[model samples]
Target: MKFSVFTASTPEWSPEQAVAELAAQGWDGIEWRVVDQPASPDGRPGFWAGNLATVPLTGLEEEVPRLRALTEAAGLDVSGVGGYAPCKQHDDVERLLAATRALGASQVRIVVPALGHVAWGGRLPTGGDYPELFAQARDDFRWVADRAAEHGVKALVELHHTTLTSSASAAMRLLDGLDPEHVGVIHDLGNLQVEGFEDHLAAFQLLGPYLAHVHVKNGAWFRDEVQGDDPLATVGWHHEWTPVNQGMHSVVEYLRTLKGHGYDGWVTLEDFSTELPLAERTAFNLAYMRRAWEEAQ
Candidate 1:
C-alpha cells in the first residue's frame, strides 16, 4: 500500500519543491495533474494553486522525462497522471499515455462525464439522449484503452459526478467488454458525496478487478436558500472540497473499508480545498491518513 497527493494541491511550488515537500511530508508518490490553465493564479500553495504550466499536452515528450527524474530524485514515485481531456479526444489521450511511460507511472486517470453534473464542464450530459451518450462514451473510452495499451499504461475512468461513471456499476458497464489490462476505474467517493453517492461495498466489489487506484477527498452540499423559501426553495447544491475527516463522510471509515476489501493499491489524496496553509494541510492530511491506515491495519 502507498499514499500520494495530487500535484494540483501544490500549484505554487516549483516542480522540484513540490516533490521534495511531498516526500518530506511522508507521501510515497505523485499523482500528476496535467491541465491547460492554473485553476488558481494568485496561488499561495493550496488546492487551487495547482502545479500547472509544467507540461503543455503538445510538449509532454521531453518534459515528462525531466519531471520524472526530478520526482524520483526526491524519493517519490509517479502514482498516476490525471488530466481533463475527454476520451474521445485522441490526441490528448495519446500524449498522456506517453507521459505515463516517461514518468514511470502505471496508470492514468480520465474523468468520465456524469449526467446532470455542471462542474464536469461541457462534456457533461445535463439533459438529452441517454442511451446515445452512454454508447458514445463506451466507444470512446474503448478506443482510449486500446491506444493506452500500446504505451503499456492503464487508463482509469474516474468515478465523478455528472458523468457516465457516476457510480461504480455504471462505470463497469461502460468498460464491460474492454480489457482490464488497459482500462480500469477510480473510486472517487468525494465526487459522489455531492449528488452521486453509491454503495461503497457493492461499488468496490464490482470494480475491484479493474480498480487501478482510489481517490480520497471530501466534499458536502448545501442548499441555495436564495432561490426561494426554506420549504419551497429551489435547492441548488453548493458543494466544496474540505480537509479529510472534517467533511460529510467518515473518511477514516472509508479508508478502513478499502483496506478491509483487500485493496492494496494506491490511496491518492485530493483535498481539493484551498483553505488551509500548504504545509499545515499537507502535514495534517498525511498524518490523518497514516493514523487511519494504521488503525485499519
Candidate 2:
C-alpha cells in the first residue's frame, strides 16, 4: 500500500519544503492542493500559510513540469490535486484540470456544497432543506463526472458532514450511474468521526466498490461546556484533533477492511493536531501508520 500526506497537514511548508521534508520523513506521495489562485472559500486554514505546498491554476504550462521534476528528484509522487470545486459551479474546472495535469496528478478532490447541519473542519448550523439540495446535487454530480472524463482525470468526491455525499449510501447515490473510473469516492475516516457515525462494515459494503482513494486522521470527541446565551439550549460533545494513535476511529481495522477488498491505493495522513509541532506530528503519524499496517497484516 502507498502512504501520502495532504499538503494541508504541513501548511507551514512551501511546495519544495513539503516535498523535501516529507520525502525525508518517509511519505510516498503528496495530495496536492491548488489554491494559490484562490479557487473558492473551500480553501482551508492552510491557504493562509504563504509557505504552502500548492500549484497555481495559472502558469502551469511551465510550473507544473518544474514542480514534477522537483518532486521526482526527491523520490515522491504528486498523488492528487485537492481544491474546493463545488459541484454547483463549473466556470473554473478547465483551469483546475490544467494545473492538475501539469503537476502530474491523475485525481482531483471535489467537495459538494454544505446543505444541512455541519461540524468540525467546516460549518455546522441549524438544518436546511437537504432533500431539495439533493435533487439538484444529483444532476450536478453527473455533470462533474462527465467533465472529469473529458479532462482525462477522475474526480474523487470527498465525504464531509452535512453534504449530500456525507454517508456511504449518499456517496453511492451521488456516484450511481457515473463511471467509477472517471469519478469515484474518497472514504475519509477523519470526516466521518462525528456524532452520527456510520457502521464500518455497512459503509464499506456500499462504498468499497466506488473507493478510488482514502484519507485518514485521528481525533477523539470531548465535551466542551457551551456557555449558551439561550437558556433552552443544550450542550454537546465536539471532536478535538489528536495524534494518529489517539483517535476515535480504528484506522488499523479500517485499513484491514480495505486490504480485504483489494484496495492498495494511497492512504494519506491529514494531521490536524495543532498541539504538536509539524515535524514531530508528521513523524508520529507516519510511524503510527506503519505500525498499524504491520499489525493489520
Candidate 3:
C-alpha cells in the first residue's frame, strides 16, 4: 500500500518539474499518463487538449528511457500507465500495450468509451443497438486482457462515467466475464458519488475481490426535481476534489477496506480541482495521504 500521485493533476508542469514537486512532498511513486495525445506529450499544450490526429509514434522508444531515468533520479517509481482504449478498434489495445511496455508500467488503465445519447450518470443505454455495442466491448476487453498478460502488464478497466461499468453492479457483471488474472478493476470513488456514499461502499464491497487499482477522491450528491433530472446530475459537489483529509471521504475506512481485501497495489491520488494552484493542491494531497497511511498502520 504505497502512495503515488497521478501526474495528470500537474498537467501544467513538465514531467521533470512534476517529479521534483512530488519528491518535495514526500511521494513514493508516480502514475504517468501514456495515452497517445499531444496534450500529454513532452512539449506544448501543457494543460489542454492538443490535436490528436497529429500525434506521432516515432521517438517514443527514445523518450521512454529518458523519462524513466528522470523519474528514478527523483526517487520515484513508475507505478502504472493511465491509458484509453476505444472498443471500436481492436488495434487501440495493441497500441496501449506497446506504450505501457515503453513506459515500463506494470498496469494499464483503460476506459470503455461512451456511445449514443445516455442520461447523465445513469445506467448505460440499453436495447436496440446497445446489445451490439456491449458485445463489442465485451470482446474488446477480453482481447485486451490477453494482450496485456503477454506484455507482463495487467489491464484494469476504470469505473468511469457513461460506460457499461459505470456502476458497481454493472462493473461486477463485466468483471465476471473476464479472467481476474489478466483483467481487474480500478475503483474511482468520486465517480460513484452520483449514487451516494452508502451506494459507493456497497459497490466497493461487491467489486472488492477484483480490485487491482484505486483512485482516491470525493464528491457530494443531491437531487434537482425541477429538471426531472436523475439524482446523479444534481450533485453540486465542488471542493470534493481537495486533499484526502480535506474532502468528505473517509480515508481511514477506505484504507481499512483495502487492507481487509489484501489489496497491496498503488493508491494513486487524482485531484481534478481547478480552483487552487496545481502544485499546491498536489502537495497538500500528498501530505494528507501520508497522514492517512500512518493512521492506517
Candidate 4:
C-alpha cells in the first residue's frame, strides 16, 4: 500500500513546505486539501479554518501548474485532491475535477448530502427529508460520474459521519448503477467511530471493486455528563479524535484486513489528534504506520 498525507492534517505547513517535508520524510504522495479558506483571525494556521496547506477553489485551474510543478519537483505524486465539493452542485464538482485532471491526479473527494437529522461535518439544517435527499444525491452522483469519466478522473464519496453514504452499504446504495471505475468510495476508519461502525473485514468484502481509496485516523466515543443512573438512560456521546495507537480503531488490524482483500491503493493519513506538535505528530504517525504496515504484511 502507498502512503500519503492529507493536507488538512498539516495546517501549519505551506504548500511548498508540505511537499518538501513530505518528500524528505519518505512519504510517497500528498493529498491536497482543496477549499477556499478564510484568513486566520490571529494569523495562525488551523485545521478547519485558515489552513495554509489548502489549495483554494478560486482560480483552481490556473493554480494547477504551480501545484503540479511543486509536487513533481519534490519527487512526490499527487495521490488525490481532497475537495469539499457538494455533489449536488455541478459547477463546484466540475471546478474540482478540472483542477484534479490538470494536476495529474486521478481521484477527487466529493461530499454526499445529508439525508436526515445531521450531527457532524455538515452545515445542512436538521430534519432534512430522507427520501427527497436520497433521490437528489442519486441524481447528482450520476451526473458526477459522467463528468468524472470525461475528465479521466474518479469521483470518490467519503464515508463521513452524518452523511447519506456514511457506511459501505449506504455508499453502495447510492453508487449502485454507477460505474465503479469512474465513481468509488473512500473508507474512513475514524469517521466510522462517530457513526457507521462496521466489522472491518466484512465491510472490505462488501466494498470489493468500489474501494478506491482509504483515509486513516483514529477516534473514540466519549460520554457527556451523566443524566441519570438508570441502566438504559439516554446518555449523550461525542467523538474525540485520537492518535493511531490511542483510539478505538486498530490501524494494524485495519491494514491487515485491507491487505487480505487484495487492496493495494492509496492510504492517506488524516490524523486530527492534537496530542503533539504538528511536525512531531506527522513523523510519529508515519513511523507508526510503517511499523503497522510491516506487521500487517
Positional deviation of residue 175's Cα in model 4 after best superposition, in angstroms: 0.5
Tens digits of lDDT, candidate 4, 80-181 = 999998898799999998888999999999988875776544365646687888888999999999999999999999998778887899998989889999
lDDT of 4: 0.90
What candidate 1 gets wrong by more than 4 Å, as runs, is: 38-54, 114-119, 122-128, 223-237
The prediction achieving the highest lDDT against the true structure is 4
User: Against the true structure, what is each candidate's TM-score?
Assistant: 0.89, 0.86, 0.79, 0.94
Candidate 1 deviates by what RMSD? Answer: 2.8
Measured with C-alpha atoms, the lDDT of residue 21 in candidate 1 is: 87
> Scored by Cα lDDT, where does model 2 land?
0.76
lDDT of the candidates, in the order given:
0.78, 0.76, 0.68, 0.90
From the highest TM-score down, the ranking of the candidates is: 4, 1, 2, 3
What TM-score would you give candidate 4 relative to the actual structure?
0.94
Candidate 1 TM-score, true structure as reference = 0.89
Per-residue lDDT of model 3, residues 132-163, tens digit only = 66667787877887888887777887877666
Candidate 4 at residue 105, lDDT? Answer: 94
Q: What are the per-residue Cα lDDT tens digits for candidate 2 across 192-257?
A: 885325876677777756888888987888987878588787878888777777788788998887
Relative to the unseen true structure, what is the C-alpha lDDT of residue 155 in candidate 4, on a scale of 0 to 100? 98
Lowest summed lDDT window (length 10), candidate 4: 119-128
Cα lDDT of model 1 by residue, 1-297, tens digit: 799988776666677777888999889998887756544455533343345424455566768778888888999988899777777777888888888887899899875655642544533345645587788888898889888899998999888776777778888999988889999998887988865577787778888688778999887767655754567656566887777877898877887788888889998887767678777788898998899888875
Residue 169 error, candidate 1, Å: 1.4
